[model samples]
Target: MMLDSETTKTYTRPISKAWWLRDRGHFNRRYFMFLLRELTSVFVALYVVLFIYEIFLLTKGPDAHTAFRESLSAGPWIAFHIIALLFALYHSYTWLGLTTKMQAAGRGLVKIGTKTLPPILIALGSYGAWIIATCIIAYLFLTL
Candidate 1:
């Protein structure tokens, strides 16, 4: 059973049983930066909500603040931070990559801004952040 090329749909290639065997490296950007951006957005939203809830509890009374702070000492606390760390890293990478794209500028549309920062420099910053984050995570694993 195979998905007919005419009936199947993908930006670069049709869905098929042989999809896994297909050279996906050549696949288009349809499944792309938007996903990473959305994911990071979701994580940021969750963080805001969680912190807001904590603030609410703090305003309610001292016991609530104690419970909220105590929650951070447990396993779930570590998991939350780990997920946040991954989302944050992806967000940074995507932002830096997209930023380097040349943009047309000026009200007359006669000029172009060729990019203030070099792509390699932005890439280095992104990679540098990843290395620093990985080291921190490794340290946490060893000590915690």
Candidate 2:
């Protein structure tokens, strides 16, 4: 996008100096918070929906529940869960990784730090933390 002075001038919302400094010059910390919360919200919704489907099957009687149990024990569903987990992991890494690199949706490149470490390092750290946390959680659940 050609975000020249004229382009900025044509913005539907008035541009403030504070906004530019926050989003363009400084790291877009606000967006970081929003994305973090939004991602979690979406994940929770999906989880609830999946559980509702399972609950529905359970209520459908012994045959449906038995089939559901069999399907849950099946390899394909396990594969699907693995795929979903990996997808979420990758998506989170990419989203955070872009935080330091993404410019305003239409503005010029926004630099975050003077000697900013590459975003991949943060992304790698996030993935590592997620793996550890997920394992710990799964272990606790399984044991319980």
Candidate 3:
């Protein structure tokens, strides 16, 4: 005996191309921040590409590398660097803060003995390490 079966079509709601840009016909602070964070990632990726390109330029000879560095000192390039730096800083802050957020949400807790660490301490420790590393790098670069 053959069994009879009915095939059902799955329904999918069509999404607009700009759905991420629009949230329920309006924009909110949380949505705006989400977009900003995503945009920062683009800036960060561009920064990484630019850094790699700079490294590649070094292989072309000092003149070529110096020219690239000089061009980057121009007003527009300076502004772009500043903007990218801001975005990168914001991105890093949010990325590192995720640990604290997770702790607060009771999702990814770090335990010491039988007690879980608080979010504020987690945030401070992460940011503190960042500051220390930044200072050390800056010191080495400035000395060099």
Top-scoring candidate (lDDT): 3
Q: Could you give the candidate ranking by lDDT, starting with the highest?
A: 3, 1, 2
lDDT of each: 0.68, 0.64, 0.87
Against the true structure, what is each candidate's TM-score? 0.51, 0.40, 0.82
Indicate the worst ten consecutive residues by lDDT in candidate 1.
102-111
- Weakest ten-residue segment in model 2 by summed lDDT: 102-111
The superposed Cα distance between candidate 3 and the true structure at residue 30, in angstroms, equals 1.7
For every candidate in turn, the CA RMSD to the true structure comes to 9.6, 11.9, 5.6
Query: Model 1, range 3-109, lDDT digits (tens) per residue?
Result: 56697773454455434333354544544445567779888888888889989998989988998888887998889979997997788766655533422122221
What global local distance difference test value does model 2 have? 0.64
TM-score of 2: 0.40
The lowest-lDDT stretch of 10 consecutive residues in candidate 3 is 1-10
lDDT of 3: 0.87
Winning model by TM-score: 3
lDDT string, candidate 2, 46-91, tens digits:
6568789989987899999888778877897788667656656656
Look at candidate 1 and tell me the lDDT of residue 2: 52
Score residue 20 of candidate 3 by CA lDDT: 62
**Which of the two candidates, 1 or 3, achieves a greater TM-score against the reference?**
3
On a 0 to 100 scale, what is the lDDT of residue 74 in model 3?
97
